[model samples]
Target: MSQPEPGAVVDLLGVLAYAELTAFDRLAEDARLAPTLTGRAALARMAAAEIAHHVRLTDRLVELGADPAAAMAPFTSALDTFHESTRPSTWLEGLVKAYVGDGLAADFYREIAAFLPEPDRLLVLEVLDDTGHADFAVREVRAAIVADRRLAGRLALWGRRLVGEAISRSQAVIAEHDGLADLIITGTGDLAGVGRLIERITSAHTERMTTLGLNP
Candidate 1:
């Protein structure tokens, strides 16, 4: 496979960078949904990591001579739509969204990183949420379900809606940004490769839902 043009690489990096920034902000805001101080603190800490990632991405964008804001602008709407459409109604619902959403995102990034060159690949890997975050989310979801078995049904339904909204917004991003799609195809090298990437992400998401006692 050929290396992506420098401009395309910059665009891709910009998207990733901006994604981190928005994620940090969103997570911080969503932390208020937490039922306890501990849960709120955990989410806040996760948000802090996203801020660090945003800064790193911004620095890299500067090194590459691209405007970080401009690079991120194109993606704002789609991402905002996803977050808005799937805002969680309760503390347990929030945990499920974080768990399911971040799991799929991490899996997607892992597959996409395989197609990127050195530093970018390493950067993406570095920004992935550690197992601690996933475990925290899982524990919260499990405890909530155990407290009220009926919650399993509500949270599971909410999780499904969240996934659907996420997919819709993702497809919107793909449709709106040819450059983003190019990055994926160029990195992976074909439609089949893209499909495999999605398959892995979806499978991981399913497993995460099951682990939380939710029907995928």
Candidate 2:
């Protein structure tokens, strides 16, 4: 917290702003794959939540004297690559992606936010709030698996792939953005702190998978 704050806070907010906007778009597109009207509507609600978060972050960036669009621009390419590479081929896969991918990102960002000064840290946590969709995703996916037990194995594998892609993209982001890496390392107080943060994220993911009756 002793180091300069504006650049890191702005960068973090920018990344989050774009992430939320893209999440809204992705969830809306994925909704088309939903098997039922109720399921589609649920995804639609989650998409709305993402947009709300995006607006909050964008406004915060402006209040901090940053252009929302310009701040989000640097992360646009990398995040797009991440979504493109991890695009879901099936409705079930999309649910698993939404649940697992979003959870992982939230966990990681929350951990880093702990290192920020009071203002940015609080704003980041608030924006990263759960959309109350985890339970819905777990219930829907579990019901589908129960109806077709064979789907369990496929979805478990899909969850693992999402985790893998998330990790790869995160590593690339860190390598390409020294400020982001510094923000995380400094927030954690050291590299060991970063390791523990990642461990926490993985543990949380395992719990979510188990809740869904999927292998971690």
Candidate 3:
């Protein structure tokens, strides 16, 4: 018989599976706020990509002998809360949220994946790849900010709010999921290492803000 998968690995994949699925939902909703047909189409395409990634994660969960639904259940509340709390009120805010949230999650997951063995690490990184939306967000947000200089300040504040909400939700999730916490601690070799990991993620977020012409 095949050996059972590690709990930490299952936790990682489970959370990611739910995250991708919710991202699909969020993007589809955001697409409705698009000012132009082209913008709507772009977000629609990105939403499709999110669903595809969700399927990939669910498939891997099944192969590991876990029910995809059960694996994702634990994360539903936390992720949902995060989304509801950060729902964008405007088209530009939606675009900024997508860009900033995706970047933050990608950075955090990439750091955690470093601790995972072989195929799991590869799978996590693969699903976390950009769904071709970053450049679109950058172009859209920057153009809007140029037309209305006040938007730069507003979106900059929005970006900071997104980061804060994401990090807070993540910490709650980590505390509740011991396996996930252990994975991070083990991968980092200690609490201090985990701090460094957060620092790196924060640094990446600052760079993403700069790329969008927003204040970090």
Alpha-carbon local distance difference test for all models: 0.79, 0.89, 0.92
Pairs in steric clash, model 1: none
Off by over 4 Å in 1: none
Q: Ten consecutive residues with minimal summed lDDT in candidate 2?
A: 1-10
The number of the candidate with the highest lDDT is 3
lDDT of 1 at 67: 87
Candidate 3, TM-score vs. the true structure?
0.97
Tens-place lDDT digits, model 2, residues 24-55: 99999999998889989999999999999999
Q: Please, what are the lDDT tens digits per residue for candidate 1 over residues 3-23?
A: 766766676677678778777
What TM-score does each of the candidates earn? 0.93, 0.96, 0.97
RMSD of each: 1.6, 1.1, 2.5
Q: Using TM-score as the measure, what is the rank order of every candidate, best first?
A: 3, 2, 1
Q: What global local distance difference test value does model 2 have?
A: 0.89
What are the runs in model 2 whose C-alpha is more than 4 Å off?
1-4
